[model samples]
Target: MKSTHFLFLLGLLAACNSQPKDKEKETEAKAEQPASHEPTVNCYQYATATDTVRLTLVHVGDNINGMLIYQLKEKDRNVGSINGTMNGDILLADYTFKSEGTQSTRQVAFKKAGNAFIEGYGESAEVNGVEKFKNVDSIVFSSSMKLEEIPCK
Candidate 1:
């Protein structure tokens, strides 16, 4: 009877010990795992970009409308052009790019935050001899501005 009880206890210990090895195998499988190659809904949510920008910053008091164009003037740029519709701060342009005189179009995105854009890219240009994207935190077009459409062509 003593030996029977001892054997039963030993069997219980062996069963318990096997549980940990099973768990370790599971853990190792997870640890040596692969990252997610599948796309998730959150990934699409973050990528849902706004189509246009409405200014809410500096002295764009009146309704001014036009297009924006960025050129690779003194650098190595592949393309350039930012032609869009403007309603005060809101711009809806068909941005284009011409590198080596080839043209392609992309929608320009913009948003106004405080004195400047907290997000979005607008065509900062030499408006009236001053670059638009320079020290300006807002767009206040005056007489000196010479609107430069992009792609330089």
Candidate 2:
């Protein structure tokens, strides 16, 4: 009778030890599952008939921060950086840049078109104490002045 009782106790111990293997498998399965999210960064470059522009933007929550380079051919160039918020596929920011040995600030807007950016152009106007383009319309950019996206560094 003592041996029967001992065998029963041994059987209970074996069953308990087997459960850990199943638990380990469950843990491994959870680890194998894909994460709920993946990080991403937006970058682009555009070439026009008279200029080349590049952008490298990092998304911070709903806002964006990055650099902007507008180089002209045989003319003055605007080189500076930008920081602003995005509305849908559009970005409106204040561009503080140097052109022809002078520094000035202006408000500019850009519209995303697939892998390209269509810069908005309009008559000069003052808004919020800064020089900005008013009467924005998509008709401003010609096909030769479109900016195309390039690989990020």
Candidate 3:
């Protein structure tokens, strides 16, 4: 009876030890599989006589993230990051930026044209210290600040 119990214990230990190897093999198989899609990056810039804005966008599937920099003459430069989603031809995002050593967050919208993106403007109200559009549907996409596609440097 003792010998029988010892054999059962040894078998349990062996079974437990084998489980990890199976898990490792599964992990290896997953590692060998290719990614479904690679992230695509696009850069754009809007320049005028006194202001210049640069935007770099990276898209991974439906998600988007990017950097935005605003350099306007006589105003503090704002450098920030934006993350949001693309709904149809409209891109809605949250812009978090720093200017004059102060941090601010706001919602931004852009309309995609043939080869450029036009910044949208509308009435906004401060909510929880962040500025958001009063009505997203009412936002006007007629700003002259059009960011033209440029090569990523």
Candidate 4:
């Protein structure tokens, strides 16, 4: 009887010791891994009373890269190719475009709203007798200038 009881105890210890290896194998089989491809692009468009703008953005882990096209009705306009970084709800980009048959670069920013975007307007200054927005962000966008998002074009 003593030998029988000792064999049963030994078998119980062996079973308990082997359970953890099985658990480790299960965990290894179920571990989650990161995706192998980039996400899709997101596009948005808006039209003001006198101008139309379109934006296309690709997001990768909170970073953003996109394009902006601004065209005025029957007037000189800019179609800028922009690359920017996004932080929270704001995107700041350097715009390079041709306007009035001349090429120029400017820094622009956009704030995301619900199904729309609020543009950041800075203070105006005179540079070589031309008024330009400088040090902007003072004027929050009113309801009228809030750009409504249309289908991607």
Question: Scored by CA lDDT, what does every candidate get?
Answer: 0.42, 0.75, 0.94, 0.71
Error of 3 at 66 (Å): 0.4
Give me the candidate number with maximum TM-score. Answer: 3
- Looking at candidate 3, the ten consecutive residues that score lowest on lDDT are 34-43
Estimate the overall C-alpha local distance difference test score of candidate 1: 0.42
lDDT of 1 by residue, 1-153 (tens): 999999999999999999999999999999899765442110000111322222221122232223333332365344343443345455444455565676655554454323333234445655453334533345343312222212211
Span of 10 residues, lowest total lDDT, candidate 2? 136-145
Which stretches of model 3 miss by more than 4 angstroms? 1-35
lDDT string for model 3 (1-153, tens) is 999999999999999999999999999999999878789999999998899999999999998899999998998999999999999999999999998899999999989998799999999999999899999999999988889999999
TM-score of every candidate relative to the true structure: 0.30, 0.63, 0.75, 0.61
State the displacement of the C-alpha of residue 60, model 2, in Å, after optimal TM-score superposition: 1.0
1-153 per-residue lDDT for model 4 (tens digits): 999999999999999999999999888877765555585577777676777777777777656666777776897777767766776777777667778788777667788887777777676666654445676556455535566666555
In model 4, where is the ten-residue run with the lowest total lDDT? 136-145
Native-referenced Cα lDDT, model 3? 0.94
Model 2 local distance difference test score:
0.75
Q: Best-fitting candidate, measured by lDDT?
A: 3
**Could you give the C-alpha RMSD of every candidate to the true structure, in order shown?**
14.9, 5.4, 7.5, 6.0
